[model samples]
Target: MIYLDSAATSLQKPPAVARACSYAISHYASPGRGGHKPAMDAAAAAFACREAAARLFQVPKPEQVVFTNNATHGLNIAIKALVRPGGTVVISGYEHNAVTRPLHAIPDVTVRVAAGQLFRPEETVEAFRKALTPEVTAAVFTHVSNVFGMILPIQELARLCRERGVPFILDASQSAGCLPVHLEELGAAFIAMPGHKGLYGPQGTGLLLCGQTPPPLLEGGTGSESIRQEMPDFLPDRLEAGTHNIAGVAGLLEGLRFVEKQGVQSIGSHERALTVQMGEALAQLPGVEVFRSKDPSQQAGVLSFRVSGMDCEELGEALGRRDIALRSGLHCAPLAHRTAGTLETGTVRASVSAFNVPQEIPRFVRELRQILSEKP
Candidate 1:
């Protein structure tokens, strides 16, 4: 199948990722709990994965990186750790429901929303500057919107937040491995990302990287201190609780290795080139209208559009019948669609991968044109 849902989750991960996971399962052992060889081996593997993630994300200390089940859990930890009750939080309109719902659930939290599609670097900086009252403790936004692949000016916003002493948090599920991120350069306090997405790892793997000073989200057994009932107030052990996703972590480590070898810019350029080709082709097709960031520099690997006179669901199904996989509806970013003027019916989202080739774009566009011309 010609899979076009990489933004949702990448398929056909690097061979090393699968191999690492299989090794984890076959040579099973509990990490940080046992003294045997198997346990030691498992622990070593887990630590290596953490170190790899830390190195990739540019965290100073390996222990500062906390592994979560997925980006949702990581986001929850980030929101809970920084956003106290009765504090103001600013979130972009482009955030995923993973971020928006969690912020909404925080009692006494006041959310100030801004335009998702129209947000440029300068506007984002201004928003942070205007919202940095003493009462505003934190701000959350996405580096890239999963809906239309719009890339926000995160570094500029991060700098603004740094100056104002407001903790800047990023939900980077769509941009993690697809874009370059150095924790030091961005100056963000918290970053939540799914390892499965651009990281090319298996599902159920995710991580949260925090600045030099980060709050603890959960208190539990760290295996280092079984004697303490309360959680330790330090680094990853302070946040990561219970058994970890060892298999998934194994896969993620290999994924990082693959990315490191291939280079992030290369992956990003490849994905963008493919998306641009697809978007241009789609725009040229009859009865098709594409929704994308006008500026190519401000977009990611995803593209959303609609065919005139066809429901989104029908178009997605039609595309699927032709061996193409695409996502329809809100894409967990209703606010983004609202900003893009596509919320009422949603749009058909085609998210390309670094692995997608040049030939696939023309084929996808030709099939789309054919499908749109047919009667429902």
Candidate 2:
């Protein structure tokens, strides 16, 4: 099958990632839970993963990076801890439901929409200038909108938030590994990323780098402080609770290593080249409306579009029948779809990964063209 939905989750992982998980299973033990040999070994391996993540994200300390179930979990933890009762949270119009739903669920948040494409750095900075008011306690922005491959100006926006003394939480679910994320340069207060997406790890793995030590969301045993009833005041320990996802973290560590060896810049360039090729092909096809930046360099490895007179779901299935995998509908970012003016029927999402190449693009384009021309 020609898999084009890496944005949802990367299917094929590196061999080392699988090996790491296998090693963890065979050596089965709880990390940081006990003084046993297996426990120590497991804990050491877990810390190695944390260190690799720190290096990749440019986080100052490995302890600040906490492993979570997924990007949604990390986002919820950051939002719940950062959003105050009387304060406002600034979010872009093109935000995933993960950010919007939780904020809407909160009684005190004031949502604002700005007319700026995420790929336009100046527009993103201006969006913050309009949204970051005195009452705004924190701002949540997606590093890359899931619906479209719009790469937001995170560093510029984060600078504005830093000046205003408002925490900036970046949901890097779509751009974490596909694009460069320098946590230090961005000065982001919190960064939420799924290991399964760009990192090419297991589905259950995710990372939450508490850049500025956000408040605790989950309170429970961290296996470090046995005497404390309340959550520890430490960074990751304060937020991390219960038994850790050791195997998942192990796999994620291997994925990070793979990314480092492959070089993030090269992977990014490769994915963008593929996405641009597909975008051009789709644009030339009759009745296809491509939703992405005109400049390929401004976008990530995502392509969103819809063919006229065809249902998004049916089109997706048609492509699938030809062994071409694609995602359809909202892509968990209804606000992005709404902002891009593609919300009604949603759009077909083709998210390319580092594994995809130029050869796969033509097959996908050919099938898509056939699907669009065929009768329902």
TM-score list, all predictions? 0.96, 0.97
lDDT of 2 by residue, 301-352 (tens): 9889998888999889888889999899988888887777787999999998
- Give the 10-residue window scoring lowest on summed lDDT in candidate 2: 112-121
Best by TM-score: 2
The numbered model that scores best in lDDT is 2
The sequence of per-residue lDDT tens digits that candidate 1 reaches over residues 177-222 is: 8798877778888888998989999999998888844565666677
Query: In candidate 2, residue 35 scores what lDDT?
Result: 95
Q: What are the clashing pairs of model 1?
A: none
Q: lDDT per prediction?
A: 0.83, 0.85
